[model samples]
Target: MTRLMDQEQENLWDSVQILSQINAEKAKAVFKVTIEKSLQQLGITVPVFSTIRLSVPSTDRLSQLRQIEKKMREAYAHQEKEKAYEYLVDYIERLSQMTEDDPLVVRKKLLASLLNERYKRKPKWSAKRYRLSASLSPLLSKQVAAAYYTTSEVAKKLGLSDQTIRRMCEKGKFPGAYKTDGGHWRIPRKIFITTPEQDERAEEALQQIDIKNQKAGYVDEFDL
Candidate 1:
């Protein structure tokens, strides 16, 4: 399997280079064959190919196609083979509609939205509120006003690691995290617990600080 993967990578790399040099029809042929061979090498069946209708030959179009390829590589790089293979097929089909005028920015947003839809566990209203606020500012009518923080922030407050927080999200234990446009996870503040132990700890710390300050007559310097 390792050897097959190596060969597939080589083929894909060679095909990418060749795609830039060849005519559109030839490039398409090479790409299709490479995809097919790669799928076969992995003991997977290739789905029906989607034909890209290129209206123009330009660097911008080439770049979009390449971006699609990059997305495919990134998606499959660490995923289960069966799932990765399936996603790649869908990605290639989407790539076929490349036009020089089609905005890469919009394309990327569309791709992210699609990918998120595919893997999303469920709608998280609280996470949605934070994300919508950050992106749209004024807030969409659909957004609920819920306090959201990142996993890191939540982890710090809860005395947990970001990984543990993420596991909570996956398990539907955490209320929900909104993945920001920039891909940062946002946790709803409403879901956070300020336990009695936390309050006790905070109070203890304040008491210690107060005691130290009193000996030095630093009462004016302290707020608590």
Candidate 2:
């Protein structure tokens, strides 16, 4: 009996380590199976564990700004100059609203100002730039107010239904969870499970954003 318990404990620890390495979607599937098997092996009839809670620090709004910049890059790559300009203008507007003292935002705003000036000086550069910006004004105004995980995202990670996550949030089961001004539940990333790969991808994307920003003649303080 002692040996069996020891082996099960070891297996449980290994399973947790694996969970921390994989993406949330994949981890949910593995979590259910592993927990159940581990319990059965220990001769437990009832499930002992409920939800797997993992905490990661919350990312700033700059991450979303970086994502919008990537979309702009993709648009330009596809020769969608109109779409790219729309994304650029939207990106600038978001930067303007950010209250953080991030120096990167200042550099990006400068680059965007330069790009906007180029557009005015050379209308032939993108004939649809003004027209699309005007048409997309309403859409651009509907920005995501905060950086948070949706109920569905939390639900998948916790192996619960979306409704259940919503209920839990309402009952204050999740610390740091709150409803947006629009009345939608927003779960902070700090209370959410995150994988190392996700963090690596976010870091890579920020590095790319910085490189692109620097190419526009704004040098980083570190580079100086």
lDDT of 2 by residue, 109-179 (tens): 44544444334342344312222233455654233223356888755443457987788778865545666
Error of 2 at 133 (Å): 21
Mind sharing the TM-score for model 2? 0.27
What tens digits encode model 1's per-residue C-alpha lDDT throughout 113-157? 445534657654444444553456455523533456667765555
Q: Global lDDT of each model?
A: 0.47, 0.45
Task: Give candidate 1 regions above 4 Å deviation.
Answer: 1-4, 7-11, 38-47, 50-90, 99-224
207 Cα displacement, candidate 1 (Å)? 80
Worst 10 residues of 2 by lDDT: 42-51
Name the top lDDT candidate: 1
Give the clashing pairs for model 1: 52-96, 147-189, 149-187
What's the true lDDT of residue 85 in model 1? 55
